[model samples]
Structure formats: structure tokens, C-alpha cells
Target: MMNCQFVFLLLVIYMLYLFVGAAIFSVLEQPYEEQLREKVLNMWDDFLEIHPCLSEEKLEDFLRTALLVKSFGVSVLRNISGFEVKWDFVSSLFFAGTTLTTIGYGHPFPISLSGKVFCVFYCLIGIPFTLSLLSIVAQKLTIFLRDRPLHYFHHRWNTSNNKLEWIHAIVVISILCLFSFFIPAIFFNFLEENWGYADALYFCFISLSTVGLGDYVPGERSGQRLPALYKLLVVGYLLLGLVCVFLMVEIFKNLLKHNQILSLFLLGYEAGRQDEEIDHVSTNDSEVPFAPRNDETTRRRVTHSASPNEKSYGSISPSRAPAIIT
Candidate 1:
């Protein structure tokens, strides 16, 4: 009976996913990005008006938007979960690639109440799985990044010592930090007049971290239309940035376990101790020969035992007397 009930619940969820999820997936497409933003913003405003405790200024409007977008975006990914792309194997690969990166960009979303619930549930479960999966993929990508021509400078200049791993890690991280955090931020500051560099940095960090605080997004400058190509590019960049961070963390972990520095320190200390012991042994060699000493009583006992054990003491008394006389 319990099994039947479980199966029934699952069936309902599956059906809910099919119709409602498809609706949300379709509605969440790039065409609706602005609309969703506006709706969420208006809702946010109303929320603050109702509860003055919810301060709008402190929260910052941009961060609010990023959160909403991320929430909706995650919902969209969850809604479309398990839907396979069929536009040939190649196109399908592209679709799968985009979905995992959270770049749904309107290709999919959720509709009905059940679907929305499912989406929320799915994301709750799926996001971690998605992250783990992406991490594996990023590890593979890191190998390629490390082999790039410029990496040679990092690898060669760093010493043969264990600290070299950290040096290499720092180099890789510097490249990622500059491109993902600094470069985008600089561009944003130029494009959006009056926006502070801090805000730009904040935006870059939020986006790259996938926190999508929305408080400071790019292309939100005055009179700017959110360009489709730009949005797509931003999504891709964020994904790559995250991958870079993961790779850096992984490399750092590997360096810690490398054991080169620790082993060298331990072995070097041990060798020094051994050398001192050897020197002491050489000095002592002239003072005494290495041999055991026996007392006179022990030596006497050995000599007596070797003398053929006169009369083999355990015989009868009469036999013993006869031997003595002989």
C-alpha cells in the first residue's frame, strides 16, 4: 500500500512536469527576461512598501534583480530537467551544454502550480548535482588551460621546491581573477557612467560566483536594451569563471598533498641525525672492541659441561661406585 502511494505521487509529479514544466520552460525564454525583471522589481517594491522593515535601498535594487533572475533561472533549469534535445546529436550536445551552465536563456521553464513546486523542488535537489557534474567537467577543462603556451613561464620560473606548486596556482588564479573580475568590471564602469568601480567589482564577483545578486548587472546602463548576444556571452563567461575557480581550488588541494616539501624537510632532518650517530660510532671504535664479557663462574660451568660429564650423574648408586673404582 505504501509502495502504491509512493508510485502514485511520483506519477503525479511526472505529469505535472510534463505540462506545467514545459509551459514555464517556454515562458522563461530570453524574450521574457525583461518582463520577468520588471514584474519581480514591481513585486519587490510592493513588498518594501507593505513592510517598511524590508529596506529597498539597503538591499540595493541590482542585487535584488540578480537574485530574482537566479531564482527564476534555476526554476527554468529544473523545469526542463531530463528533457533530451533531439535536433541531431550535435545540436543536442549544444542544448545539453547550455542547460547545465544555467544558460537556459528562454529555451525552457515551468508553468502550473505543480510544475512551479516541482521546479523549486528540482532545483533544491538538482543544483548540487549540477555543480558536482560541472566540477568534473571543469577539472577536464583545467588540464587544457594549464597546457597553454603562457603556462610555461609559470612552470619554468617556479623553483623545483614544493612552494613552486603554490606559485603555479597563483599564476593561474591571477589570470582568472583579471579576466573575470577586473576586465568585466572595467568595461562596466566605462559603459555605465556614474557607476563606481566598487559596484562593477561587486557585479563581477556576484556574477562569477553565480550568486546573481542582480544588484549590479552589466548592460543595465541607461537606455540600454539587454542584447541577446551579450546576455548569452555573459552566461558563458560566468560559467567559465566558476570553472576556473573550481580548478584553482582543486590545484591548491593537490599541491597540499604533494608531500615534496614535507618529505624533504623530514628526510633532511633524519639524515643529519644519522650522520651525527655515525661520527659518534667512529670515535668510540678506538676506545673498545664490540664484544660480550662473561664472568668466571659462567666460563667454569661451560668448561665442566665440555669435560664429558664424568659418570653421567643420573645412574644408580652401585653403578656410580663401580665407575669410581675403575
Candidate 2:
């Protein structure tokens, strides 16, 4: 059974390899088809010249339009393969990495329908699964780290147990927000050297949110050249933002525990094991235990029965509370 599954997997892999290889070959061989098509058209034109009804100018225009359309298609194919431009090995690596990561960064986008379709499908299926898997791994890592809290735990041990600790967390988070968000915005704004701080902040917000509104792109402000540094910065910020968001959520959870305790106090509730018997008695008056005592019982009682914590309630009185039992 294992051998059969292995063979099946290998067969599937082989089929995928063949499909990819064929796609590449088709793209590469498209020029030959175009040449053959041109040759056929030239022959037809020769034949048409003997009995020409269409004007030369009109024919020329038609041919020009056809060539333009053909060029467009060819350009698209080349763009999808990342072949049109002369890129170094590092640049190619960056492109491939960003594409797979789904950050796409939009500096290098798919021009062809085939490329766009592949991107749509790839991101649709891949991003969620990848994110979910990463989240799971992060959660496990968090537990491991908590077992040994890094850096902050040592600081926490010496600090007083007060609101200051929570403030410390907020301060750290604020610093992170500044670096992860504000620094990039400042740099981009400097490059653009035109937009106001508000605009920069808006751009930063939109980018971090992954809304990609396209109203403002930082790299576009500067003419396109080695976008690698900017791309790396943006990708790094995105990744750090993700991790920071996770950390903040954990901090909020911890803070909420204190909120819960505060709520208990505000609501006049004691945080301890409650006497369930009191609850049962309060639920129904008919279920409350009663003992009848006449006037003779009140006169004969000489000993004090109530503890200092208990209030004495005389039996057989309309305004009387229930007699306290030891």
C-alpha cells in the first residue's frame, strides 16, 4: 500500500513537471508561430495585389494594428516569465520570493492574464493555509517562550506590582508602532518630499492594513529603479506588524484578567467559594426550613445563642428575620 501511494505521488509530480515544462516551451515557441503567420499573410497580400479592392493605406493601418496587438501579447508573455528586463541574480531572487509570499509588493506585478490568473489562484489557496500554519507554529512558540519569558521577565521581577507595569508594556508597544509604521512613512515622505504628514500617515495605515488602495504608492513617487531596498523594508514591516499584533493581543488578554477582578469588586461580589445552601434558600421561600416557637419558648430561653457575626432574630414575630442556626 505504501509503495502504491509513493508511486501515485511520483506520477502526480511528474505530470506537474511536464505541464510546467510544456507551458515554458509554448511561450518560447510562440515567435515561430508569429513568423509563420506573417509569412502566410505576406503570401495572401501578394495574391490580393493582383485583384486589389482595399486601399494600400487602409491595409497598412490594419497590418499595423495587428502587429501592435501581437506585440502586446508577446510583451505579456515575457513579463510573466520575468524575461523582458535584465535583472541580476539577487533581483530575480527577490522577485520570486515576494511573488510566492503574496506580498507581490505590486512593484513587480503580473501583466499577462495567465500570470494574473495564476496569482489570483495561488494567493487564494496559498495565503490562508500558509497564514494558518504559521499561526499554529507561532502559538506553540509563544507557549515555549512564556515558559521562559525573554528579556522582560527579568525586568518584571524587580518592578513593583502596579499600573506602571502595564504602562511599560504600552510604552514598548508605542515604540514598536513608531518603528514599524512611522519610520517607513517618514522615509517615503522624504523621498516624495511633497506630501504632508497626514498623507504619509494615511498611506502607512492603508499599506499596513493591506488595503492597497493604490491612491499612494511610495516607490512610485521615486522613478522605478532597484526597488529591492524599499520592497525589503515594506515586507519586513509587514512581518513585524503581524508579530506585534499577536503580542499585543496576548498583552490585552493579560490586562483583561485585572478587568475581570475589578468588575467583581464593582458589582459587590466576593471572590471566594460561596455557601451554596444560602443560594438554595434564597431561590424559593416555600423550600425554606421553619421551626415553630410559641411565647413560652421565648420566655424560657436564658442562654445567648448568636455569635458576634450573627444577628439575633426573635421567633414568632411578623417583622422577625429567620432564627440563625449554628
User: CA lDDT of 234 in candidate 1?
Assistant: 58
> RMSD for each model, in Å, please?
21.0, 20.3
Q: Can you give the TM-score per candidate against the true fold?
A: 0.41, 0.42
Query: lDDT by residue for model 1 over 1-326, one digit each (tens)?
Result: 44445456667878998999789878878568888999989988887888898677776875766666554433223433322222334333333444455543333344358966865676666667778977997788667765453366556675454465566667877887888789878877776776788888887776556555445544333344434444555566667777777787666555655666643433444555677789898577534422222433333333323444343333334533655454
lDDT winner among the candidates? 1
Give the Cα lDDT of each candidate: 0.59, 0.57
**Cα error, candidate 2, residue 237 (Å):** 2.9
Taking the tens digit of each residue's C-alpha lDDT, what string does model 2 give over 11-57? 79799999999999999999999999999889868967875887877
Clash count, one per candidate: 13, 0
Model 2 scores a TM of: 0.42
Looking at candidate 1, the ten consecutive residues that score lowest on lDDT are 79-88
The regions of model 2 sitting more than 4 angstroms off are 1-111, 133-165, 222-225, 261-326
- Give residue 319's lDDT in candidate 1 (0 to 100): 35
